[model samples]
Target: MVERCKDAGITILPSAGPVAEMFNGKKIASSTRARDLKEGQYPAAVYVPRADTVERFLAPQSTSATAPSRAPHAILI
Candidate 1:
């Protein structure tokens, strides 16, 4: 499915207004420059830049995963 979506070309565009991610009652990430990505029939994903994220709230994962069409990415905790 992922490979098929990659072949179809994912669409990425700037999101309207701001985008934010919250955990518990705390804000982990917030960005006005966040991007909305849509691939095939999947739900859109909002991607916030690392610079807009709160560093104190994010801990880098020891191991990272790499997607076939994307670079290796760390899972924050």
Candidate 2:
């Protein structure tokens, strides 16, 4: 799915706090949806590129990435 996203020219920004580091950071992570699928998915971990190597990556992304508890209807994508 991630390969497909890249092939389709889709920029898959991380959806969760820990995963956001992948695009430009050393951590490998994923969205909550991915975590829920862990039982069915084989690889629990993923490889993410470091932010130091990329210019498009966002910094302190986790802070702004969070959706408010009151605004549960907000769409992250």
Q: Give the lowest summed-lDDT range of ten residues in model 2.
A: 68-77
* Best prediction by TM-score: 1
Write model 2 residue lDDT over 38-77, tens digit each, in one string.
2123433333433323443333333232433222232211
Once superposed on the true structure, which residue ranges of model 2 sit more than 4 Å away at CA?
1-15, 19-40, 52-77
TM-score of each: 0.76, 0.19
Task: Give each model's whole-structure lDDT.
Answer: 0.76, 0.32
> For each candidate, how many residue pairs have backbone atoms clashing (under 3 Å)?
0, 4
Model 1 residue runs over 4 Å out of place are 1-8, 66-68
**Scored by Cα lDDT, where does model 1 land?**
0.76
